[model samples]
Target chain A: SQTIHQWPATLVQPVGSPLSLECTVEGTSNPNLYWYRQAAGRGLQLLFYSIGIDQISSEVPQNLSASRPQDRQFILSSKKLLLSDSGFYLCAWRNGGILGDIQYFGAGTRLSVL
Target chain B: AQTVTQSQPEMSVQEAETVTLSCTYDTSESDYYLFWYKQPPSRQMILVIRQEAYKQQNATENRFSVNFQKAAKSFSLKISDSQLGDAAMYFCAYRSTFGNEKLTFGTGTRLTIIP
Candidate 1:
């Protein structure tokens, strides 16, 4: 079984502060990792996705950035956070092959930028 | 570009009743995939069901099933004997068969099961 871990579960950050959210997947190697944000009572917005290490594709232009340091370790970072950056951040992983790939999500990290 | 649409913004059903949530998508590709994800109050996105476009038979998982109409581009979810635990935001998602396809999600429909 594959499991994804994300932390800190919840964070309160002042505006313009640096931010870092980490996601690591165990029991799977070379998986496709994705970063998504969901606004209050709204649908999810894809921020970034990585197929492999050092290969990141950003869907939306924002203050946030994502990196795949290892085969199963992905990190979301920002040099300076904005008020609009506050949302529930989700890290998901899927199989890296041509089979029927279903994404498995982690318990999201809630960031409140005050 | 592929797009997903969930017509109902909110729906309510009594416990043990049945409810159908409508979903339609626009895609140019013949081979693709459609999925329904459930987001509970905890906000964890969980995969509820999935259907491959090339398949003729509708996909079913226990009390959950999908009506996949490839020509109509309609994929609707039917929840039978709805339980209180079924209350959540249901999102319709689409992914293309070609390339590194990313999922395009619909504006979810909030389902409330009245006990």
Candidate 2:
């Protein structure tokens, strides 16, 4: 069975502070990773996705960035956080094989920028 | 570009009753996948059901099932014997069969199960 682990389920930060949220997958290799943000009572917006190490695609211009350091390790980071950056961040992974592209999501992190 | 739409923002059903959440999508591609995800108050996404465009038979999982109308570009989820645990925000999503594993998600419909 595969499992995704996301850290710091909840965080409170001051404006302009740096942000780092980590996501790691177990029991899978070369999986496609994605980052999504959901504002209160709003739909989830795709932020970034990585196909492989050092390969990242930005869906929309924003303050956040994502990285795939290893086959199963993905990280979402920001040099400086904005008040608008506060929301629920989710990490998802899909297998690279020919199997159905069903994405598995992590627990998610709720960030509040004060 | 593909887009998903969940027309209902919120719906309510009495416990042990049945409810249907509507979802429709637009896509030029013929082969693709549609999914229904549930996000409870805890805010963790849980996959409820999935439907493939090529499959004619609707997919069902226990009490959850999807009505996939390819020509209508509609995929609606029906929950039978609804329970309080079924209360959550349900999202409809779409993904192409090839290239770009990114999922296009709808705004979501909040389901409330009354006791």
Candidate 3:
């Protein structure tokens, strides 16, 4: 069975600080990875997605960025965080072979920017 | 561009009762996919159910089922015998079949199961 793991389950970072959130998947290779954000009482917003290594597509223009360093390792980073950047971040993966494939999500990382 | 709409921001239902959460989407593409995701208090996005645009029959999973109307562009989720564990935020999402894997999500409906 495939599983997704995200680290720093919860974080409290000061404003303008650098941020890094990692996501890794097991039991699958060449999977489609995605990064999403959910503000309080808001819907899941797609921030970035990668079909392959070094192929990140950003949906929203913001301070956050994403990278796929390995086949199953994805990272979300920000040089300087903003107060609006505080939210629950989710990592998702889908089978690359299936078009419009269903996505499986990780436990998510809750970031509180002060 | 595809858009998903979930009108109800909050909903409450007594335990063991049935409730239907409505979701509608607008898409120019004839072939696409619709999905319902559950975000619990922990804020984990879990896939609850999914419906393919080409399929005519509704999709069901245990107590959860989707009323899919492709022509109407309506996809409603019906939770039968709702349980306390069902309390969460439900979101409707859409993905185009033509190489767009990014899901466009709705505002979500917070379902509260009353004891």
Question: What stretches of model 1 exceed 4 Å from their correct place?
Answer: none
- Return whichever of 2 and 3 wins on lDDT: 3
Q: What Cα-based lDDT does every candidate model obtain? A: 0.93, 0.92, 0.94
DockQ of 1: 0.67
Residue A15 miss distance in model 1 (angstroms)? 1.1
- On DockQ, the leading prediction is 3
- Residue A17 displacement in candidate 3 (angstroms): 0.9
What's the candidate order when arranged by decreasing lDDT? 3, 1, 2
Between prediction 2 and prediction 3, the one with superior DockQ is: 3
Clashing pairs in 2: none
TM-score of each candidate structure, all chains considered together: 0.97, 0.97, 0.97
Error of 1 at A18 (Å): 0.7
Q: For each model in turn, which proportion of the native inter-chain contacts is also found?
A: 0.51, 0.51, 0.83
Docking class of 2: medium
Which candidate wins on lDDT? 3
Q: Candidate 3, residues B1-84: lDDT per residue as tens digits?
A: 788999999999999999999999998888888999998898888899999999998999999999999889999999999999
